[model samples]
Target: MRPILLSGHERALTQVKFSKEGDLIFSVSKDHTVCAWYSANGERFGTYKGHVGALWTVDVDPHTRLLATGGADNTMRLWEVQTGKLLKTWDYLTSIKRVEFSEDGKQLLGVTEKRTGQLSHIVVYDIDSNPEAEQPDEPTLRIIVDELPRVTVAGFSFLSQYIVSGHEDGSVSQWDAKTGELITNVFSHDADMQVTDLQWSADRTYFLTASKDKQAKLHDARSMEVLKTYVADTPLNSAAITPDPQSYVILGGGQAAMDVTTTSARQGKFEARFYHKVFEEEIGRVRGHFGPLNYVAVDPTGKCYCSGGEDGYVRVHHFDPPYFDFKFEVEREAASQSRM
Candidate 1:
């Protein structure tokens, strides 16, 4: 399938997200800029100008009117999506590594990096969707992660009942969303591999985590059980779960840029690999990015998928007819049997 390339960032991209309606894409990069692009033709729509340091993560509200970003500026900022207006900024001691809106967009969550004298923290704030409304200056709840390794990625879970976090030591912890209490913890990935990304399913009932261990694992939100694992040859940086009509997982990673000059580089690891969700077998791949892919985001509408890479470009790809028709032998047989 042909892909639409959006070159909006000057440095390596860290995260990419699609608006709920699937009409717009938001991307953040190490260039310290945030860009908005049209999904249809990859047109540059607008840029949110702030953040002195490199941006690490970005997310849009469900209504598409609000935007949130976290960065090395040691701050998490909110913006008015339509006008590109800066709404509020929350300062922290260290870099803000991740930011996400809750399922209903009623709350926002951010993860801070642990450095020097500062400890990593998972903070939640009640969000007011209206652009003109003054956002709160203080977090509603803050969970100081002193008991575990630094948090690398985190987000809200099903019904906003739980908060899930991935750690630098390759562990996943579940917390009470309202009271900031630790519920349970699981060492889902290999020790010290460092979880790189965490993304939730559409319903938020379960989620996926990608790690530098060269693998991605699926976990039940409520039970904290390891549901499945998808393995790759290269250390993974990102992973995504497609929406309903499609049952697939998208994985992206490769040899880091620092390792490229070592003469041991391979090409296959740079490609985005797709695997069957139920069968746990790789089904296909999309290749183009020359550098390691840092993140992959599937359109909530399931109409397209995109990848942001160390190459400083976001490739948006809409699906082809074969993508919808693909099925395993068992799936085909079961469909034919139903017709009988």
Candidate 2:
């Protein structure tokens, strides 16, 4: 299979997000730039340059043309996607690790690094009414509450009622979206290894989490119980659960550059792994990226999956009939068009 090469940037990419149409790729780089590129031709769509320090993450709203970016500079800025204009900026005074758009796109959720022993807080911003633009005294809903650890909150999801966060403490917590109340914390693993990433299934019934413990865990979102676990060779940095909620593909290896250490050189090539839910085992692993893995997302349909890593490469992978019998029609079209 021929691989489509997206031009590498000067600095390492911190995060990548795809538009709802699956046509464009949004990337946040340590070079302090947020860039949008055509996933097909690798064409540059637009760039936002308001971040003062290394851009840590970028999230796009599904329904509206809005973008949220967080940086090492301890700020989260909201942008108008069409004009690339900065709408508002919130200062947190700590490194902002991840930012996510609520499912309905009405609110923005941000998780910041914890310096002191104080519990980490998830800040919710109301973007609906820009009362600050009209009435300076208008209240902006900023809630500070205890969270799992201030470690990398690599993944987050919000349904119509609740918001869920996956944290470095190897746990996933559900909270009330409207009141910011803690509902429950689901402990999937015994160790404190970072739960690097997570994604909810289409119906919001189940979610998947990847951890530094070299495992990907599936949990029942409703009961908060561990459903299954897939053992990996190295640390699993990020993962994306398929739309079906039955399976998921994980980006294995931490988000660090690969080097030929005596111990690791004897190991093997680093790559991503795919697990089958029904069989409850790892059926396939793709050794495409040479560097440590960063992120993985299965297109809305369950067919094809995309991964980006520290090698500054984004690879879109395709599977044949036995593994994936065209379960995801939308992703199949993308894979067909790109010849992935």
Candidate 3:
């Protein structure tokens, strides 16, 4: 499939996200800007340019009406998605590393980096979903990460029953969304390898995590159990699960750019790898980026998938008919036997 290349960011991309309907793609970069694009043609919709420092994360509300972003500017800001108006800003002690809207969009969460003597924190606020409604200044909940390692990524789980977070020390923590109480913590990934990304399934009953340990794992959100594991040769930066009709997981990462100059692209492993979710086997891989891929996000409708690379481009790829038709030998045999 021919990929639509979006060269909207000047610097390396930090994260990429698709709207609920998969009609739009939102991307944030270390260039201190966020860009919105039409998923169909990769046409630039607009840019949000208020952050003074590098942006690390971006997420849109379910309705695609509000945008939440966090950055090194030491602030988490909200913007009206349609008009690109700055709606609210919540100042913090350090760079905000990740931002996300809950399942309902009535609440928002941001994870602050532990830096300059400041402790990492997971802060949540009551979101006014309506673009015109004034957002509150104070957070409804604040979680300080004093005992464990610093937080690297976090998000709300199914029904907003739990708030899940990945830590810098390769551990994952589950918290009560309403009471801000810690439920359990599990060191699933290799120790000392930071958990780089956390992404949920379509139903949010389970989630996937990528780590610097050269591995990605699927975990049960409620029980905190490691359900499955996908191993890779290089450290992983991001992992995403495809929605219905496709049982595959996307893994994106490679060796650092500085360390890969002497090696070719093939040896560098700068490609997005697709693995069979149920079988835990690699199905295929897509190569394009010269530098390491920082993040990968799948279209909610399972029509296409996109990857943000350190090469400063977002590649949107639509699946071909062959992609939908290909099946494992076991699957083919099952289908044939069931027909009798």
Q: Relative to the true structure, how large is the alpha-carbon lDDT of every model?
A: 0.94, 0.68, 0.95
Where model 2 places Cα greater than 4 Å from the true spot, the runs are 117-119, 129-148, 154-158, 244-247, 254-269, 301-304, 318-323, 326-340
Tens-place lDDT digits, model 2, residues 210-285: 8888888887766678888878777877767666533545556643454424335225446777676534567667
lDDT accuracy of residue 84 in candidate 3: 98
lDDT of 1 by residue, 1-340 (tens): 8999998788999999999989999999999999999999999889999899999999999999999999999999999999999999999999999999999998999999999889999999999999999899999999999989999999999889999999999999999999999999899999999999999999999999999999999999999999999998899999999998789999999987787556333553788999998888999989888789999999999989999999899999999999989999999998899999
Worst 10 residues of 1 by lDDT: 260-269
* Number of clashing pairs per prediction, in order: 0, 0, 0
When sorted by lDDT, best at the front, the candidate numbers are 3, 1, 2
TM-score of 3: 0.98
Q: Write the per-residue lDDT of candidate 3 for residues 144-169, one digit (tens) a residue.
A: 98888999999999888999999989
Model 2, backbone clash pairs (residues 3+ apart or across chains), number: 0
TM-score of each: 0.98, 0.83, 0.98
